[model samples]
Target: MKDETKYSQVWNLDKLYPDGSASTQFLDHISHIESKVFSLEEGLNFFNTPKEINHSSKVADLIDNIGCIRINLSQANSYITCLLAQNPQDQNAPTLKGKTSSISARFDAGLKKLQKILVKTDHHLWEDMLDTADLNPYKFILNEWRKKADMHLTDDEESLVSDLMVDGYHAWGQFYHSLIGSIKVNIQVDGERNELSVPQAINLRSHPNEEVRKESYYALEEIWEEKKEQFAKILNHIAGFRLQVYKKRKLENILEEPLMENRINEETLSAMWKVVSKNKQPFIKYLNRKANMYGHTKMKSYNFWAPIKNTNQKIKYEEAVNFILEHFSQFGTELENFSRQVFNNEWIEAEDRPNKSMAAFCASFPISGESRIFMTYGNRITNVLTLAHELGHAFHNHAMKSINGINRQYPMCIAETASTFSEMIILDASMEKAESGEEKLFLLDEKLKRSVMNFMNIHSRFLFEERFYEERKAGIVSSSRLNEIMHEAINEGYVGSFDNPSIHSWAWTPHYYITKSPFYNFPYTFGYIFSLCIYAKAKEKGKEFEKDYLALLRDSGSMSTEDLVMKHLGEDITSEAFWEKGIELCVRDVEEFITLTS
Candidate 1:
């Protein structure tokens, strides 16, 4: 019998375009944006005179035109990216990407000129510009631009930096991406040799058999070891370039830019970490119990994701879809309807295939008011939770549909809130429905593993990145030194839970290679903890909280992280008390796992 539900399905990209081929509509839109960007650049000349610049009609029209261009560019860029992600081997993808990059560079040049004009304008006139009725929708974006303008050089210098970044700074990131994608490692499983990509090898850490997991770990280590020197050079040049840029801007702290990017302050970050650090003992205890179950003295990096016992329960894709919808409905009808729209529209690509990307992401198109989720589903419980996670992101986008353009983009810190909250919903529901102690234990184990990873593993990555930047300021850090720093960070994060930590950790994390966002690791922890707090509130308030939760998601793009939390949850993010409460919920889970195992 051929079961349709058993097979993996490719997503329908026709929603973005009639076909993968570039159509006249796409080309015309790109041309229109290019012309608009050029016109905006010419409009910058009007800013020379306060009278002309302060004319409310002139400023309002300019803002509206810029917003239009931004929306069109975003839609086009999203389409190109979706096409590329669907098929990395698409020959035309590169050409289209280069063209898009050129368009983006030109737009950024015009934006720089605009920023200079706004920065040079008198304070009252800039306020008047913002107060213009037609510019009301772009108030948040314009205000943000004014703040960012303080950190930038002159328009010409900024343009030069943007131009150089194409081949200079960002090329290092591109090199790392290409290298990792092409690299493969050979491993023997069940007396047969198999070659695996970087992601496939990494996935083996969760294999049921210890030998296979350990072998995969060593195989990955060997591959990364061989490439460590090249990786070191890439890291050095990327960091050096950032430091040079920061020096030009006279920004002393490396963390400053990332903090601003994440829309958070130092106090909030410190408070969150302090609570996380204090709560590490409970996680270490959970790890100890897990290691004992695995018949080991202490848990190693390879054993972190090791399954406690294999479950016979295999959830088909359809079953998983229904499962997520049922739980989402329990939260709200709106959420349930959103999930239905995603599944019915075939907006998800869950096929397990060769040469496809190994990670999952939810990309939302603001102009179209739609989202596409990408993941590889293999009928595991984890895959079900991943679907729920990505759908959470989709729901967030759906909620923000009514929000103005450019204001729909949220920071990474709050970005994970909906996704993690979705995981919590499914995790709790699954735990409640488990028919046996064994099933319950497996669920608890999975839950604990996730918490530990988010709280500890992610913390280690943050620590390593922080120290790397500090040391890199002196000179180029060697491959061995990178390993040493990674080991130290791991040890610190693990809190002695592991007798020997993974040194090759630095080599595999693609976060380090991402030139756009440095210190990208800490935001995961922030989102996890923040979501936990929100989840606790949802449980407490029950049905009444659903509206507020939606409101939180809708406003995520418009407010600061702290303000968002305060408005929705009535909590101060900068206080240790709030973070400690979230940690306590995690500790309760750990305590429950200990009791079950005992």
Candidate 2:
């Protein structure tokens, strides 16, 4: 085994702040933002008059101030979040979290006044504001707010809801986060007693040993069972709070906000799922093959990420970096250069250590034009792919650095496009480099694993959330009901793939607990297929497609998902034909896996 320490590097936060999280400068910046928010609130009182609203210079100045405050607040929040991710046990992290949350609340409270003014302003004046040089960059953002302005409550009511959320709605999410981060599982593996965090135990699902995987699965199930009720309450409360807010805003569809947030319509979402449902049979075939590889009559929930076979070659961290860079260079010089900068600057924390957060995410700091990636890397090819995945996010961010802040915030649907595209590049390169049949089979399995996940596993999550939300509208869903819903969704998507379904699946997913983004599950499937289609285009066009791909990434934040895809790919997302193309690509991979393994 490679020394895990050699592969790990503590990311540098100096770019965000010359001093770390506790730096005096950071605190002073927060105080400055607090004072500015108050001043902006006071200034909004003058902008209510028609004549004052038409003063382009004055309105432009106010917009600039708001933009500055938002950028600074984002920078500080990113710093604290980075610190917290690196050391979840940090005593000061929670305190800073509270402080930042309050600052955000205050800022939102102040922004509501400006929004109210815009809502009441004459349409002609609004047009003038959009055309103003200072405010033109934010035209898209302002127009979106204008579209929803009528649905908004009075400023006082909105402010009340925002403040209450700090303690009420959002607190539930925090509670869930704390519970997962602190929970420990005790399981006996190979005649030795072992204690693991929730994340560490979950990682064992991919372990090579069957007994360890089974033990870890049961241990996780037991722990989740014990907390099922609490998890249920958290989900209900979060959904309940959202429903209440939506009702007050006069919104009917629970999906309306998420759709708007993702910049896609119901037609597009429906089309994507229709194509996915039709393509599920191939994945089922792959699952059956996977079960045979494991010497089982049928697969189980624990077998989802299980390694088909283990290779003796272990990829070191430096070797992984080189491998990623080499493949990326084949695509474009820009991609390779960006990956090198990430390694040289130590922008990743991939060490295997205790108490670190579970799962990997790439966080981009637009203010500093940089990104930070968090993941625990062991010497595995999966780790190499993960590194490429995150670097894809950084590369996307790098492309968007030139855009204004408001335009740079892409929705989650398109957010995974670049990352998934990067994974495709890495997978193809690995398959080409594999020397033996066993190695080729292993690599093919890895590629097929993602197809299974995006097509079947994530489809299950989407079905579960859709049904849960529909049920939640009537009344509070009991724990048993949640389990039933989850089981039905899993069985529907994974039909005949699992001998026994995971009923407690709903209890452990952190996505259900996110208060800011509701119905966050389907975006993974959307991004995956979307990226696959883009990757196929790149393959057909050779190096010529690189420029177009980068252009798509740069424009991702500025337009709606439909518009972005249509502009770059000339494909309408609302059409079933467009989605079918992506689904067929996934099916092709499954067929290839079967051929290689057989």
Candidate 3:
């Protein structure tokens, strides 16, 4: 019963490909995308700077093909991604993934030409093409495309960079994928030893057994510690690639592309961090109290996810799903129904299996108007929250199902809006329904665990990446130096919370090696804090806010974070006060926890 692959519900990916990664249909799908990539590449040379977009339908046709190519490529890639995530050691999946990635690189080269033309297009003609070309729905993303043209090189140089990245920049990330997927964690529970996948090992972080939690943490640290040098090399090379590209683009700051990618400005980021820094003392206070509960002056880094004594901690899968859907129904019937349909239809892979991917996420398919969520559910309360969280992402995608292909893209910062908001709903509901002080404390601790993660833990990652990039410009950062930076960041964020922080954190964090998005740390904080503010608004407005929430999710595609806040909630995220308001919500819970403990 404990084996997740056997007892827990598994997602049916047959809708995606009947035979999974080995499906001939899947191969045919990839082939079609490859052909489309070639066709699109051939058309890239037929135009220069989008001539007469207002009069000629040629540019419009080109834009349409670009959209088609982009979506088709993504759909194929997403299918293979699903296959790999389930069993990272899948033999055929890697080859197929590489093929799709190669096709994607070629597709990106052609897309670069469109980006160049969009940059040089007349503003009036660009506006006319938005409507005349039937691309008005994508106005936000198209305008966004024009905004970043200052960073572009010549058309040929840009295309070449895209082509070269297939085997160079992205290849590093692919290598990391191969390395991490092969890792296995050995652990013993109740005199029985077992080998676990990285994700399964990670799930033990919140296990109720103290020794199991400690053993799992050390197992990960020991394994990743052995790979520190290799991980450091990957980190350095990944950073080097970005830095070289930045140098070639004539961009002065490393933060420029990350900030732009998240659709945020430095001021907004600065303001958010400022608010967190101001609020950290109380969070530290909570942490100190948590340490006292464990009879230690300082909580060890391995014990960060330690739980308190409680009667009800282990939540079964069936109970967890009912809890989430019930809580979601309180928010809106639509969210509840969507999640129910997804769960009933087997759209989530929650099997606790060996060689599974680490952590959880929802991947949406534009072609099918569906999303597949991946996770190894451990049946703890934390796992229930994860269930709610990923469904929120699926709901976000569902909310934007009617949106155009290009417009569906949003910055990752606001991408957490619905997910975090959904977590808040579940946390609040569980807190209110607690039957005893112990139950209340348990739920409160879970809520604050999220706070601890978003505030201290995520902050540490941000600091590490920021300092790592700064140091990387000078030379390749060493494994020892990487460890030092990681420790320093943790110490700075946690301050007096932990005497022994996890030093090998840089090695195990998949986000650090991810080539698609850098500085992925801050977005979690933004989403957490930003969603708190939205949670407040939802509670104040009650069920009516649900409509507004859906609207916000729908408009999330490519809207700047500040404008989204201003238009929906009328708050300026660039101001410290807005961030302060959000942080204050978490502070209230922390203060309550401290008082209850005292």
Best-fitting candidate, measured by TM-score? 1
TM-score of each: 0.95, 0.93, 0.90
Q: Which tens-of-lDDT digit does each residue in 516-575 have in candidate 2? A: 898888898899999989988988987778899989988887778998899999999999
lDDT against the true structure, per candidate, is: 0.83, 0.83, 0.82
Please give the distance, in angstroms, between residue 287's alpha carbon in candidate 1 and its true position after superposition: 0.7
Clashing pairs in 3: none
RMSD of each: 2.2, 2.5, 3.2
- Tens-place lDDT per residue, model 1, 1-598, is 2226632357777767675746666677677878888788778766553454347566666766776777777777877777777777788767777777788887777776777666766887777766767566677767777788788987678878887898889999999888898998898777789998888888888888888888998888888889899999999999999998998898899889999888889999999999899889988998988888888879867888887878888778888888888887877778888888898888899987776766788887777788888898887888888989999998898998887665777899999999999889998888898888888888888888878878888999999999999999999999999999999999998887886677977878999889999898889989998999988888887767889999999888877888888988889999999999888888998999889888
Please report how far candidate 2 places residue 107 from its true position, in Å.
1.6
Model 1 misplaced regions, further than 4 Å: 1-9, 49-57, 127-140, 353-355
Once superposed on the true structure, which residue ranges of model 2 sit more than 4 Å away at CA? 1-8, 49-54, 128-135, 352-355
Residues 210-258, model 3: lDDT tens digits: 7898898888889888988888888889899888888998888878888
